[model samples]
Target: MRRIFILIIGIAVLYSCRNKQTESNNIVKAIAQDTLSKTVAGTADVGDVSPKNDETVKLIQKQLKVLLKNDLKSMTNEDRYFYYEAFDLNNDKKDEYFVGFSNSYFCGSGGCSGYILNHDGSVINSFSVTDFPILVTTDSSEKFYNLLMKSGGLFHLVKMKNGKYPSNPSIEEKWKGEVPKESTKVLDIYEKKLEKYSF
Candidate 1:
């Protein structure tokens, strides 16, 4: 009788563990599905340009299309378009350029990938905001930036340092300040830009 009782207890424990494992897996799968369901969609309008140079607009459009085509070629079933804008972020006499892409792979809950192209045709920055990105603009220094509104009730601002993309800060000491709660977002931007530039 005691042997039978021990066997029953062992079976119960095994089934309990199995159920817990299945539940955990289900939760993980649900999160992954939710993330994949997010899509990024938006319009990028260019404000009036001084001197009204159509040549500059043409150049920006051509370069942006080429860059985006090359960058996203390997990804599967990609349907996206580049939205190019020219704005004077620093109030400098010269206008800076902004290029963003709409991603369909991850939709609905707001997961998308994009890059910021400098006026020189060099990519200065990039980002993937999981939440709905409300705004993407440069600061006074012409540093690329993004504002994300998360589903979980949080707001984040991701800023990339000037001339700092395409390469990581080699010195560990540079991370000295209190780590930004948005470190992951910052890091993702850096890494994406680096990957794009490295090729």
Candidate 2:
């Protein structure tokens, strides 16, 4: 009786151990899937945006990586990274992507080792910032609106001209929330589209 009792307890311990291992493996798999989704859709950030399709998401990432690797090869910031967003700057229903890089050069938040790409994956323009634009969006005429900090820490509005933002933007107001002055409907639509694609 004693020997039988010991065997039963041993079997229970082994089964419990196996269940724990399986649970651990499942957790790892879930984490990996979440990471892949974030990388593919670029929607891990509530403040950012990206392509609404899987193919476009992968392509945008590849294009941005190539541009940063081959084009900016001379740079030497080990921590340098890129964040991209796909939006229709021209309201053409086609997507344009912006690749922003991390570097010490940006004195403020909106700065990028800057590259804005067209639908064809071609660069439209690139520029760095002293006080990076806190808000970047477009107008009905497709003009880019950049809200940035200027002298005396005042917030200001700068419009893009021919794919280039002005180096010296006039003060508009103090920095507000991240929301742009663009229509709320567009933001809402994009967020919904993002959810549909991600799931």
Candidate 3:
């Protein structure tokens, strides 16, 4: 009888150990799955974090129609793609527009043309041979935020001079140092978000 009791106790102990091991494996798997889900959610949130304001977009379109009047007349609807974002460069509590062209007519081997417009749709600055991920740093030049644009595989530190950013980025000075932590990418957008000009 004692031998049978001993055997029963041994069986119970073995079963308990097996259950504990199974529970531990289940917990590990649950944690791993949770981590993976969070990573995917974070990645999906990346791209053009600024608020979508239809009024600002309309203003940009109005200005673009006049600015590219001649070019628009010659190009097809397929080549009318562009990207834009609104950001405050100065401390005036008003946002300025950043527009970039992606089509062949506006882009070349070096890069594409970008424009900065005021809240009233007036062109404030124009940039040529510019690439995306336009970085705006905390440092200001003449009360306007400094810009970092890529052209020809190099980054240019374009500063506001005499109330205007440089029109030609290829001729500007290159930024050799690391990018500033406070720099904000004001113009980066997904391909699907590119605005198609109705005109």
Pairs that collide, model 1: 37-107, 38-106, 38-107, 38-108, 39-106, 39-107, 39-108
User: Local distance difference test, per candidate?
Assistant: 0.44, 0.51, 0.79
Query: Which candidate, 2 or 3, would have the higher lDDT against the true structure?
Result: 3
The TM-scores of all predictions, comma-separated, are 0.40, 0.44, 0.72
Most accurate candidate by TM-score:
3
Worst 10 residues of 2 by lDDT: 190-199
TM-score of predicted structure 2: 0.44
lDDT of 2 at 24: 100
Model 2 agreement with the true structure over 1-199: per-residue lDDT tens digits: 9999999999999999999999999999997788668645533442333335566656656766675565455644543444455666565777766554444533355433455678877777654542333344334323553434333445555456666655444433445565453422222222343222110
For candidate 3, report its TM-score. 0.72
RMSD of candidates 1 onward, in order: 17.2, 10.2, 9.4
* Residues 1-199, model 3: lDDT tens digits: 9999999999999999999999999999997777566445532222334456788777887888888888877888877766787777897988888888777888899988878999888999888998887888778899998989899989999999999999997788999989876577766754446544443
Tell me the deviation in Å of residue 84 in model 2: 1.1
